[model samples]
Target chain A: MAIRDDFEVVASQVRTVVQRFALGLLVIAAFGAMLVGKADTVLVEHARVLALDVVSPVLEAIARPVAYANRAIADLREFASLREENARLREENARLLAWQTAARRLENENEGLRSLARFREGPEASFITARLVGDSVSAYMRGALLNVGRRVGVAPGQAVVTGEGLAGRIAEVGENSSRVLFVTDVNSRLPVLVERTRERAILAGDNSPRLRLTLLPSIAGVQTGDRIITSGHGGSFPVGIPVGEVVETSDGSVRVRPFTDFSRLEFVRVVDYGVTGLVGTGAAAPAPATPPGGTAVRSR
Target chain B: MRVDGTLAILDRWGRAALPGTVLLFFVLLTLAPLRAPYLSDTLPLLPVLVVFQFSLAAPERLPGPLLLAMGILLDLLLGGPGAPVGVSALGFVLVRAAVMSNRRYLVGVPFLFQWAGFCILCWGFVALVWAFTTLWTWALIDPVPAILQYVVVVVIYPLIAPLLARVRARDPLNVPELSRGSARPGETTP
Candidate 1:
C-alpha cells in the first residue's frame, strides 16, 4: 500500500515537470515570434539574401529541366493549335515582309536626311543576350532569374529588355545568376514619360499585372493609347526605351500595357553599359547632348 | 541467422535512422527541380509523412526536443518567409497530444477515422496560418484544391501507416511498452 502511494506521487511529479517544461517552451516561442515581428533589421535581410544565394544555383539547375519538360509538354499540346493557326501565320508573314521593306525604305530616307544635315550620332550601346532561367509570380513578388550574372557583366540596376521592349532591371546579382524585378512588382518604381505629350510620371506597381502612373496631376495631359517610355530623369534607365502603352480604365485610372509579355517571357537582352560611377562620370560622359535646353522632344 | 543479425542492426538503427531518412527525402524533394507543367502549388508530401510517423510511434520514446529541432531545421531548409517548420512541428505535437490524451477512445477507432483526423488537423493549422499571415491568399483563393489535397493526404495515410507501425514495432523503446501489455495475456490485473 505504501509503495503504491509512492508510485502515484512520483507519477504526479513527472506530469508536473512535463507540464512546466511545455509551458516554458510555449512562452519562449511566443516571445521569439514577438521579437521577430517588432524588428525589421538589416541582419535578417542579409541572412535571407545569403540563404537565397546559396540555394539559387541548386534551384536554377532544377528549374532548367522542369522548364524544358514543361516546354515539351506545352509543344505537344500546341501542335493542333499550331496547325490551325498555320494559315493565319502565313498571311501574317507576308504582311510582315511587306512592312519590313517599307521600314527599310524609310530608314534609308532618314539616314539621307541626317547626312545632309551633318548631324552627329550618339555612341552605340552594346547588348548581352541571355535566356530566362526561372520566374516566380507570387502575389507579393513578381520576379525572374536569368542565367547571366556578374561574370557576364550583368549588374544590379542594369535594364533588361526583349524584342518587344523594356522588361525591368536586375535587382539582385549572383555569380552565375541574377534576379530581375519585373515592372509589375509592388516595389518597382520607374520614371516614365508619355510618348505623345512628353508628360512625365512615376510608374509604380501595386502587385498587379497592370502598373499605375502615379504623381500625374489631375491636369496632366494624359490620354488613352499614349505610348510610355523611360524618361531618363532618374538616370538609371536609358532615355526613350519603350515601356508600354497607356490604357484608361472605366474608373478613369490610367495603366500601362507593358511591351514585354511577362507571361511568355523567355529570352532577354541585358544592355552592356558600364556601371555609372561616382558623380555619374561613367554614365554622363557617354551622353553629352540633351537635345538643347533639356526639354522633352516629341517624336514625329 | 545472418538475416536475423541484419534485421537486428536495422532495428537498432531505426530510431534515429528513420527520421533522418525522412528528413533527407524531404531535402531532396525540395531540391528536386519542378518543371512548369507539374503541379507547383500543392503542399509537399513530407509533412504528412512526419505526422503519420508520429501517430504510429510511441510518444514517450520520441523526444520532444528532437521533434522541435527537426521543425527548426525544416523551417531553415525550406525557403519560406514565415515559420512554416515551427508551425508544422507544433501542429504535429498538438495532434499527437490529442491522440495520446484520448488514446482509449481513439485506439479502437477505424484507421481511416484516425487518418482523417490527422489530415484535418494539418489542414486546419495550414489554413489558420494562411488566414493570419495573409500570404498566399491567391493560391488558397480556391479552397477546394487545399481541401482536395487534404483528402488525398488522408487517403495515402492508410498505405503508409502500416509500414510505419511495423517500424515502430521494432523500436527498442516501444518494445518495453508492447511487452508489458502482452506478457500475461488472459490474466487480468485489477
Candidate 2:
C-alpha cells in the first residue's frame, strides 16, 4: 500500500513537469514556424521543385487513369448525344468537302507559282505528334505535359502547334515526358505580326485569359479583328503560322483571343526544324553585301 | 514486456499486411482516377477521409506521431504541398479528442447527427486554415457549394465508414486493444 501511494505521487509530479515543459515548447514552436514561414519562400519554392520532380512520374501514372476515366465518361455522354449530332455532321461534311476541293486546287496553283518565281527555300523542318497527358486547372501557371519527350526528339525551346495554330513550346523535357508552356502562361512571349498590315508586336500573357500585344507603336496600323501570325524574325518559331485574332478591349488595349483552347488540348505536333545554322548563314550572307556597299558609298 | 509483445505483433501485421493493403487501395483509386470532377470541385473527398480516420479510429490505436507520418506520406503521394497535411491531421486529432470526450452525448445521438457535427467541425477547420493562407475568397465565402459538398460526403459516409470500421475491428494483431490502454491516463483494461 505504501509503495503504491509513493508511485502515484511520483507519477503525478512527473506529469506536471512534462506538461509545463510541453506548453513552453509549443509556444516556442509556433513562433519559430511563423518566422520560418516568413523567411523561407525561396526554400519552399526549391522544395516544391524537388518534390515535383520526385512525384511527377507517380502523378503522371495516376493521372493517366483519371484522364482515361474522364474520357470514358465523356464518351458515354457523347453516345447519348450522337443521334442529334449525326444530322449536323452530314451537312457539315458536305460543306467541308467542297472547301477541301477548292483548297487542293489552290495548293496546286501555289506550287506552280512557287516553282516559276524561284522563292527562297524555307528551312527544312520535321515534326513529331504527341498526346497531352495532364495540366493544371488553377489560374496561375497554365501549362501541360505531353507524352512525347527527349526519347521522341522533343526538346526545350521547340515550338508546339496544333492544326489550328501555335499552342505553346516545350519548357521542360524529361526522358519520356515534357512540359509545354502554353501561350497563356505569364512567362510566355512571342514575336507576332498582324497578317493584314504586317505590323510587328510582342504578344505577352499576364495570367489573364486574353494575351496582350505589347510594343505596338502608337501609329502602327493595326485594327480590331486583324489576324496575328508569326513573323519568322525569331528562329525559335517558324513564320506565317496563324496565332489568333485581335480584339480591342474597352480600355483601348489590344488582346488576342488564342486560337487553341488550352482546356481542351489533346494532341499537338512538336516541330524540329533543324535550323540552328540557318541564322548564322543568313547573317554571313548580309555581311558580304555590306562591304561592297560601304566602299561604293565612300567613293560617292 | 506485455506492451513490447503487443507492439511486436502490431509491427508484424503492419509490416506484413495492413499498410500495404491500404496503400494498394489508395493507388488503385488514384489509378482508377475515379473522379467526379463536378463533385470534387465543390467537395474534396480526401480531406473527408482524413477526418473520418481521426474520429473513428482510437487514438491509442493510432498514435498522433504515426498519424502525422502517414499524413505526410499521403501528401507526398498525392503531390501537393506536404506540410499542410501534417498540420491538418494534428488538428483532426485534437478535434477528435474534444468530440470523444463527450462520448456519452455523441454515442447516443443518431448517426446523421454525428456525421453532421463531424463535417461541420472539419469544414470549419479547413476554412479557417484556407483563410489564414489567403486563398481566394471563393474558397471560403461560397458556402452554398461547400455545404452541398459536405452534405454529399456526409450522405456517403455511412457506406464507407462501416468498411473501414470492419477492417479495424478484424485486425488480427489486436493493436486496437493494446492502444486503447494508453489512450487515457485512467484506462488500465487492455
Candidate 3:
C-alpha cells in the first residue's frame, strides 16, 4: 500500500509539471502559427481549402433539413402576411409596368445610337449558382463557404451575387467548396462609383453591417439615395453591377447600405464576366472567352 | 477471460473519449449555417465553453495538445481569409491554462460559483481574441459584435454546463470519487 501511494504521488507530480510545460509550449506554438500564417498565405490557404472540402459534405447534409425548416417557418409567416404582401405587390407591379414601357423605348433609341457610333458590345456575364453551406459568424470576419468550387468553374475573384444585388467576391476556391469574402468584411475593398453622379470611390468594409465609401473626391456630391455600382476600374468585379445605396453622409463619412441581406443569404450566383485582370488567391485567371464576332475579346 | 479483459479496456478508452467526441460535435454545430438574426451575426462559443469545462473538470482528459487542435480546427472551419489562423488556437490555450490554474476553485464548488468564474473568464477570453485580431489585421474591429457574442455565450453557459458535467461524470477513472476525501472545506465533490 505504501509503494502504491508513492507511485501515485510521483505520477501526480509528473502530470502537474507536464501540464505546466505543455501550456507554455502551446502558447508559443499558437503565436508561431499566427506568424507563419501571415508569412506563408499559400500554405494556410491550401490547408483551409482541404479543411473546407472535408467539412463540406457534413455541412451540406445539415443544411438541407435546416433549410427546409426555415422555409416552412417562412411559409407560415408569409401565410400570416399574405394580404399585406398581395396588396403591396399589386401596387409595385403597376408602377413597374409603366417603367418597363419607358425602358423599352429607351433601349430601342440606345441601340440605334450605338449602331451609328459603332459601339463595341461589352462582354456578356455568365454565372453558376451555388448553395450556402457554411457561415463564419466570428466577430472579426464576414465570410461564407459555398458548396461549389473549381469543378464547377467557380474560381477566386468571381463576383458572387444574390437575387437582390452584389454580396461579395470569392476569396478562395477548393475542389468542392469555396469561401466568399463579403463586401462588409474589413479586408474587402472594391472600386465603385455613384450611378447618379458618376463619381468614383472605393467601397471599404469595416466588419460592420454597413460599408463605407473611401477615396471619393472631396468636391463630389453624394446623396443618401444615390445608387452605388462597381466602377470596373480594378477589374476585380464586372462594371455596373449594383452594389449598394448611400445611406448616410455625416461628418465627412459616407455609409452605403448593401442591397443583399447577408444574414438571409441562402443561394448566390458566382458570375464570370470575362475580365481576367484581378488575379486574386495567387492563381492566374482562366483564359478569357472568345466572342462570336471574331473580334479580340477577353474570355475566362 | 481474455475477451472480457479486452472489452473492459475498450470501455475505459471509450469513457475517456466521450468528452472529445462531445466537443467535436459542438464545433460542427457552431459551424453549421443556421442563419437566424442574432445567430447569423454571432454564434455562441459552444466549443470554447466545452474546452473550459473539461479543463476545469478533468484536465488530463482534455490536455493542452487537444485544446490546440480544437482551436486550429475552429480557425480553419471559420474559413475567413480576413481573420488570420491560430487566433482561436491562441484563445483556447489561454483559456485552458487560465482554467487549469483555477481548477481547484471551480471544481467541487457550487454550480453558481463555477458559472460566475466562467462569466469572468469569458470576458477576458473575448477581449483577448479581439485585441489579438486587431493587432493581426491592424484595424479597429467594431466591438459591438464581439460584445454581442460574449453576451450570448455567457447567457447560455448555465443551460449547457449540466450537459458538460454529465460527460465528465461518465469517466471510468472515478475522478470525483478519488478526490472526494481530499475535498477541502466549502467544496462539494461533484
Candidate 4:
C-alpha cells in the first residue's frame, strides 16, 4: 500500500507538470494568433466567418424562443392600447394616400425634367437580405453580426437598412457572415441633409442612441422633428436614404433619433450600389494621347 | 447525496466539465444581443467575474488553458472594425495571474475584498484596452464608453457576487479528502 501511494503521488505530479507546459504553449499560440490577426485582419476574418457559419444554426435555434417571448410581451403591451393604435393607423393610411397621389404627380414631372436635362444614370443597385443573428454591440464596439456574407455577395462598405429607414453600414465582411456598424457607433460619421430645410450637416455617433448633427452652416434653419437623409457626399451610400429625425432637447444640442430601433433589430437589407469610389474617376478615358511635345512612336 | 460522511468524487471528465460549461455560458451571455436601451454599452462584466471567481476559488477545474480559450473566444466575438480584439484574453490572464499569486489566502477571504479586487482589475483592464486601442488605431477613441462600462460592472458586482459564491460552493470537488490525507484522483473520502 505504501509503495502504491508513492507511485500515485509521482504520477499526479507528472500530470500537473504536463498540464502547465501545455497551458503555456496554448497561451502563446493564442496571443500569437491575435497579433497576426492585428497585422492582417483578413486572416482572422476568414476563421471568424467559418466559426460563425458553423454556429449560426445553433444561435438561430436558441434565439427563436427569445424572439417568440419578446413578441408575446410586445403583443401584450400593444393589446392594452389596441383602439388607440387602430385610430393612429387609420390616420396614417389617410395621410399616406394623399402623399401617394402627390408622389405620382411629382414622379411624372421629375421624369420629364430628367429627360429634358439628359441626366446620366449609374448602374442599378441590388440588395442582399440578411438576418441579424448576433448582437455584439457593446459600448466600445457598436456592430452586429449578420448571418449572410461573401457567399451571398455581401461586401464591406455596403449600406444596411431596415423597412423603417437607414440603419448602418457594413464595416467588415466574412465568408458566411458580416458585421454592420450601426450609425450610433462612436466610430461612425455620415453626411446628412435635413429634409424640410435641405440643410446639410455631419451626423456623428458617440455610442449613444441619439446621433449628433454638426457642421451645419450658422445660417441654416433647424427645427425639431425635421427629417434627415443621406447627403451621399462620399459616393458610398446612395443619395436620399432617410436617416433619422431631429430630436427634442432643451440644451440646444442638435441630435437625430434613428428611425430604426437598433436594440430591436432583427433583419436588414445590404445594398450594393456597385460604385467602389476607389478608382480616380468615372469619366470616359481620354483618347490614346500623343507623347508630350513628340509624335507617337511604335513599340516593340 | 452522501450515503455516510464520504463525499462522492467526480470522474475525470465530470471534474473537468462544470467550470468550462459555466465559463462558456458566461461567454454566450456576453455575446448575446440584449435589446435594452443603453444595454449595448454596459453589459455587466459577467465573463470577467467568472474568471475572477473560479480562478480564485476553483482553480482545479479552471486551469490556465480554459481561461486562455475563453479569452480568445471572447476576443473574436467582441471585435469588429476599429474594435480591439484579444483585450479580453489579456484581461482574463491578468486577473488569473493576480489570483494565482495569493490564491491560498484569497480562497476564503470576505466577499468585500474580492469585489474590491475585481473592480480594480476591471478598471486596469479597461485602461489597458483603451490604451492598446489608441496605439493600434493611431487615434484616441472616446473613453466615455469604457468608463461607463466599468461603472456598470462595479455597480452590479455586489448583487451578482452571492450567486457566484453559491456556484463556487457547489464545486466542492476541490475540497480536500481530509480523512485520508492523500486520496488518489478517483478516490473519495471525508
Scored against the true structure, residue B125 in model 4 reaches a CA lDDT of 75
Better of 1 and 2 by TM-score: 1
DockQ of 4: 0.31
Clashing pairs in 1: A66-B35
- lDDT value for candidate 1? 0.58
How does model 4 score by TM-score?
0.78
Tens digits of lDDT, candidate 1, A171-242: 656676666777876556777788888877788766566888876755247877888998866444667899
Model 3: TM-score, first chain: 0.85
Model 2 C-alpha lDDT per residue in residues A45-148, reported as the tens digit of each score: 34434433554566567667777777888899999999889999999999999999999999999999999999887777789998665553222244665667
* Winner by DockQ between candidate 4 and candidate 1: 4
Q: State the displacement of the C-alpha of residue A122, model 3, in Å, after optimal TM-score superposition.
A: 2.3
Off by over 4 Å in 4: A1-34, A116-121, A197-201, A214-219, A248-254, A277-300, B1-11, B37-40, B158-190
Q: Can you list each candidate's DockQ?
A: 0.12, 0.11, 0.53, 0.31
What does the lDDT read for residue A9 in candidate 1?
A: 100
CAPRI band for model 4: acceptable
User: TM-scores, in order shown?
Assistant: 0.63, 0.57, 0.87, 0.78
lDDT of 2 by residue, B1-190 (tens): 2346888889757744553355334422331223454443322334445444434544344443444444333332332221232333344445555455544434334667666666766676555444532341122232344345556666667666555544344443465442232244464334
Chain A (candidate 4) TM-score to true chain A: 0.78
The models' CA-based lDDT, in order, is 0.58, 0.55, 0.78, 0.70
Writing each residue's lDDT as its tens digit, candidate 3 over A100-172 gives 9999999999999999999998788899999998786678778888999989888787889988889988878
Residue range B1-190, candidate 4, lDDT tens digits: 4333324445445545777888887776665666655554565367887777777656667766677777777777776554455667777777777767655445555777788788887788778778877776666678887788888878888887666655444445546332111335675445
The whole-model C-alpha lDDT of candidate 4 against the native structure comes to 0.70
Q: Arrange candidates by DockQ, highest first: which order?
A: 3, 4, 1, 2
True contacts kept of 4: 0.38
